[model samples]
Target: MTRAPAPGHGGMASTRTHSAEKKRNSVTKAPTRLWGGRFEGGPSDALARLSVSVQFDWRLAPYDLMGSRAHARVLNRAGLLTDDELERMIGALDDLEAACRSGEFRPAVADEDVHTALERGLLERLGALGGKLRAGRSRNDQVATDLRLYLRDHARQIVSRLVELETALIAQAEHNLGVAAPGMTHLQHAQPVLFSHQLLAHVQPLTRDIDRLRDWDKRAAISPLGSGALAGSSLPLDPQATAAELGFDAAAPNSMDAVADRDFVAEFLFAAALIGVHLSRLGEEVCLWASQEFRWIEMDDTYATGSSIMPQKKNPDVAELARGKAGRLIGHLVGLLTTLKGLPLTYNRDLQEDKEGAFDAVETLLLVLPAMSGLIATMRVNTERLETSAPDGFALATDLAELLVRRGVAFRDAHEVVGHLVVWCQVNDKDFDDLTDDELAKVSPHLTPDVREVLNVQGALASRKAYGGTAPDRVREQIAALRAQVNDHASWAADSEA
Candidate 1:
């Protein structure tokens, strides 16, 4: 009998034959199942489609590998693996990690989830020895630990981006320190405020967001690695050693709680959603400022997009997307909360619904924060327009009222006098600067010429000397304090990354 030619041995004929043989092997191979010893047959195609999560959870591959390494060490300490076996296992895992990072190893079509795909890779590398690593842990505890590691790493990234945005706001405030703008109450000018004051207002909410993330980290640092299935393993595995190896503060106190708790994910979603809301508010202002009607800011050509139909248009699409994505971020939070609301779990299939939304939320904020920071940093402020419009719509009327109060006039009476004076000025088509001595006396005897001192925009802005006020001096102090806070937050984020 003649033996078949070896693959790639004969020119084109051998290459074609090799391709056919590889295709046949792929078609005939069955997926490795992690569990199913009790089942008589495979799951239906419909069940398989619904159950597979390797598409999204595959992003957790790195974290999953880290968990496996830690588990291998713990198993070695328990004498489940010999010293030679442990070293071999570590070498194989390191090779697998390189393949994963280089995109050479990936999930096969039948892989159920990240864990199953990674296990298959391990088996391919080490054969029967790979099975030993799964001795003390279940997918239940494994997935829980992987997600915490994933979120903990990404949370630092989110904080660093937040600090970048805050630093941009601080830079804008410092650059426009002396500029004045009309501050609005009901979208109508209410007072003359230093432009720096408005920019710094956004920084305050972001500081709180950073604090929330830092606080959330404290609760998310516990490991769940040895919490097998639900009730923990009966083996001699050391969970504390695994937790320390994985960078967790401690192993979970209770195995059931360890696998079932998704509160960390929910809390993270809340923090992300609130950051979205704050960005939405800032984006709304950017949209208004960039419009022709406001013209308080001019969008930089690099950051702003042009309309395809309107050549003259420099649209604030960056800010508009920031506004639009806030809704998407909020929906992710609510969707995850709804998924988690009814599950009575030690570990239920419903819990698998958690990863996609949390992953998307983190990715969305990471995208939005940097774009917004560049927009704020590069946009040009129209200081002349801001100062010119600062005292429009009788914005200084409150200053006049307060002046009368300081002269021993009752506040109620002073308010009444200022109200009438505004009416007279409106009907006569004149502002406070246009008012004659005879006209002031007729409007209100208390409208003495001394009131003129506070009627102008400069005087209106300067008179607010109280701490936290919009006075230029107060704004300078606020900027200094905020800079120190941003520096501290930057240091915290750096430590987290380290």
Candidate 2:
């Protein structure tokens, strides 16, 4: 229930009050406002309500404190603070962090944002010396620095989780090796493919997503700490030193761009949104495969829920949520892009809209990636159903065409022949298996009984022996490649954290 003291209170205590109660009251009195030099009055209640961001941005407190610590070192290097003052400042910040961790510190309603609250906490801890911490920094640059640091840490976390999810997929593919399934085009059964091939298809895009996070991290690694407001700092501050302290790769090249650039956030949102879309596609399959019509997979009890009204009804709530949340993730990306689009230059209060969406996305994927991985890891795959379904719906039609091509029939002629046969089968309520050699030969002289060799599921699978194809060996190669890629990222994420 403890709140940060109001602006300017900065925890300054008056020692001259005679009565103990009066002395306590005087100690807790609001101090002079940090930016009240020209203002005759404080912000209106509505303005305060509209402006305060600490409610959500408090998650950035640790990053803010980290930035402050880095800034403190830079300040000492600039001779803005003595070594003694720097020592006291670090100790006080450490105490403030402990208080924040223990729930002993929280933002006051009067505080505008986390920056304001932490400044107040620091002032309370070190009195006047705490005031020096704000000398060469503006909240604008400090917030930019904090957001980058926060996202860098979180991006690594996201990478690690992605690796877990990828590993789960690799395991699933390895477990279900050579199990055949119907692959689709436009949601209609188009071909017979190994279940492992389908699983590795999903793995390919996720690998690119991890690559995107790694690429974004490189750009986001630059420090914006010494970029005062929208211009470079007047003081002789060493941005490289600050960057090194905060684990950034370098200082930002342009101070204005440094303060105003939210491309990093937009890129992160885009990455998260794409991740959502990928997971939704995976979720849709789970929902489909778990249904009575498909019955290709049995939902694990741990990852599925039963309906309240129906005794026999098990609902795919987890998959459904993952599918639904994709829209939310897209909305977050669009909303943030819109916020950034119209801003003219430099820092704007509108930038306050940035943190919540980014934070929600990070937290959301943290849950979703693990849940999806667990769902895949534990679910029972009905390989019999998958194999049985693989050759149905004339799924081997393409293989029939290819077999004709091998028989020296022109591809166009083969395609038309197969197309006609497909319509004929549909109208006659018969499948390729029911076709007579005479009937097939009537359509094309080249359609001999030997063509029947390629009309079944195994032949359909074996014909695709090219690299990246659905043949068992190719799929095994894909899984191995995917595992190596996942392992590389896993190593990078672990090393980066170290």
lDDT of each: 0.88, 0.85
Report the Cα lDDT for residue 298, model 2.
Answer: 91
Model 2 segments beyond 4 Å from truth?
1-28, 31-33
**CA shift of 297, model 1, Å:** 0.6
RMSD of 1: 7.2
Per-residue lDDT over 131-187 for candidate 2, one digit per residue giving the tens place of the 0 to 100 score:
898877788889998888878887888889888889888898999998999999998
Residue range 1-498, candidate 1, lDDT tens digits:
011111111111222355555753573387878997889998999999999988888888888888898899989999999999999999999888887776556676778888888888898889999999889899999999989988888888899999999999999999998999999988889988988999999999999999999899889999999999999999999999999888889999999999999999999999999999999999999999999999999988989999889999999998999999999889988998998888886889999988988988988999999999999999999999999999888889999999999999999999999999899999999988899988999988898777799988888888999989998899999999989988998898787677
Regions of model 1 farther than 4 Å from truth: 1-28
State which candidate has the highest lDDT: 1
Q: Count the backbone clashes (under 3 Å) in each candidate.
A: 0, 2
All candidates: TM-score:
0.94, 0.93
